[model samples]
Target chain A: MSSTAGSTLTHQETDLHLQGVINRPYQVVVWNDPVNLMSYVAWVFRSYFGHSKEKARELMLQVHHRGKAVVSSGAREKMERHVTAMHNYGLQATLEEAE
Target chain B: MARAFRATTRGYKADLESHERRLLSQLCADVITMLETRGKQLTGDDAPAGTDAEDDYAHFRRELAGLGDQIDGSDAAGGLAPPDDAALARLLPDASSDPQEAAQFRRLSESSLRESKLADLRAARMALEGEPVSLTEEQAPVFGRALNDVRLTLASRLGVEDEADAEQIHQMAKAGSAATTEALMAELYAFSTWLQETLFSAMLDVMPEDD
Candidate 1:
């Protein structure tokens, strides 16, 4: 018998796996920075996310004390948009593969 | 013949204390309407020159739409929650604090409430005064000091800090890197619109309406 396990032949199967991998969820993370004020960070959250002042302040404090916070998480495209917004707002924001 | 005398009564109309409270409530509403737009401009992705009274307004609506998102995203955004009835009972103003100043702070805290009306109020007020104001939220203590300087200058010159002049509130944003010209302009426009509400609210508290 031919070594079927060693030889990959199903193109459709490979494509399916690739698609699934590409569709995996991504995370949007806002890192704590020295420059932006805690209040400003809260404002960004309030301004960008429509958060209440108390909620925004709590998140800001979380980021301030926690070193970083995952401000959002979702589809890669959505995470990318969030990251771009954070950048626009001058936050040290980033996106990465969610573990 | 004489008209029958009737006691006209609306519980609190003539009460100086209630009028002061009313003044604060009105001012709070006005400031929220005006400054909310400027606060929006601070982080808008659009180009600056594109904004005007109308466009800033439309964008303000869009930005405020994200208010829920902001609140959901950060606990801090909500700030102090409204006091529960029990908590509120214990929250009477201290005898030492000036009622007017307390009114101003209440207006400031409520500044995010009704945005569009506030924006209109701002535009009208600015046209009447022929100047502008800066409504940007303070950053660092130093920036607050700078804002005070700008605020003092504006009060002396035109009676309010004008965000239209970016040079004045230059370093108010302590964190963020240098923004592109377009980004900076957009921020400036937003902030100026924000100023309209803030100053108007403060003014309303102090500026009694003409009879």
Candidate 2:
């Protein structure tokens, strides 16, 4: 489906397409928890994932209001690492094959 | 009286009274002990014989090597079960919804995760030992992590699984510092919540505006 953006692809993006076609991608999903403070969740998004202040707050709000949010998406191995990192930060995060 | 955390030019600062600091320190220690107990269960080591700093390093290396073997499937019990204790389970949660995948993930990474959390908790303990409970920029997240663990532990005990429970806890906390065990827990939980809110607010303020 991403085939329409072909010409603008960098060499790395082209390589990513090749890999993505071969391997299904995964998403890191962070779930809502009342115990984790809102500010702490937003700070984690900004600090750990390097999301912008706006992006972090948005994702944090999504997790808060929507009960869960996809914080990141990538190869399975990379997403697994992020899952572990989130656990270390005391966040309830899980990984699954992206639909 | 204790002051909430605030951002400083150097890093972050919170003025905690002696009792407050001591209470937080004890909470960190409690979580560390719980994790260490889980660590022992994961590695199947009852008591490490390491007596001193040097010996402990070697002991740690050996255990890590054992964990490496477990990950490689050399050990039959590599796929370990999650912690039965609810509080411990909350701190170290399942990484996948699928049971098999979660077990495999836990087998591969739980020990290291537990160790890293223990390290953070220990560092936070030292940070709390100071009069003002100051954290350098480098130590801010580390301290924040340890503080978060304490909050998680308290939350687990408080049964704060949903917003309703949290609201009930808020009301309980307002019932004075200690009328009952649950009330005491609620107060401590609320205090930790306020402390963490201030710390992360300061941290977020200092962050670069964009990714």
Candidate 3:
């Protein structure tokens, strides 16, 4: 039951193309750092991102084996917020335009 | 001997000796001082500011006066640069690979990040005040973060740039000699690594697997 209340043009397609220059999704990438513990990283991914234990472990491993991993992706502002949150958790994270 | 953090009926507990507690609390206070100094630096004052025993009006006046000048600047784009000190830089890293963008992002977010980290460290000091370090479920994560910050500071001083560097530090700690300051840092780093490992492992044990 989508709300269709306030349109002079009724029954219009709400799904317009938003993936242009302005709406390109941004991602928060967490980098592997020697100071942060593996267990701590997994916990941060779980509690902060609400990832399942397995999923969080998987992402933590990716950051461990690979140089980094994109833990989240969304609007630029949201990704920026996530990057700040990751920084607050003492994890090295950078915000980038999602490919 | 410091007992590893373990899940208990109430929340989480670690049995630390008095000296250990004192050491951790002092470290927390040191980090708090570092962050407060950093905050003042970010607000564009090299001299430590705003800890007067005067009246509230004086404080408010200082606040507006300090902020007023900064806001009046024409371009907010040229923001505060990251700290030159390796420990401070590691604690608050760049949010972007691009230098300009990273500076801008640091300008926008570093203050609040510093505040939150300081808050965690203060809470950790309070937690350390007890006979046995006990944490409520809510407090555990905050304590964990403060412990991690201490480790990060030690790691920076130990020059732990990569896995190889970390291995050297581990070996140094395993040698069990604090003859030099570097060896002492390694010992503290290893101790923090063990404590944090136990903490998160206990925490993860309680969290739902949902596999």
Best prediction by TM-score: 3
* Cα lDDT tens digits for candidate 1, B10-31: 1101112333223323433344
Model 3 per-residue lDDT at B101: 81
The worst-scoring run of ten residues by lDDT in candidate 3 chain B lies at B67-76
True contacts kept of each: 0.00, 0.98, 0.89
TM-scores, chain A, per candidate:
0.72, 0.79, 0.81
Candidate 3 lDDT, tens digit per residue, A1-99?
113356453335433442244467789999998878899999999999999888898999999999899999988888889999998889999988888
lDDT of 1 by residue, A52-91 (tens): 6666677888888887777776786677567655643445
For residue A9, give model 2's deviation from the true position in Å: 25
Model 3 achieves a DockQ score of 0.75
Per-residue error for B139 in candidate 2, Å, reads 0.7
TM-score of 1: 0.31
- Considering the two chains of model 2, state its CAPRI-style docking category: medium
Cα lDDT for residue B164, candidate 3: 92
- Per-residue lDDT tens digits for candidate 2, residues B83-130, read 657899999998989866787788888888999999999999999899
Off by over 4 Å in 1: A1-20, A52-55, B1-211
> Please, what are the lDDT tens digits per residue for candidate 3 over residues B1-211?
8899999988899999998899888988888988887776555455334543332343344345442213212124555566656899999999999866887788788889998999999999999999789999999999999999999998998889999999999999999998998998898889888989999999999987664
Estimate the lDDT of model 2: 0.84
DockQ of each: 0.01, 0.75, 0.75
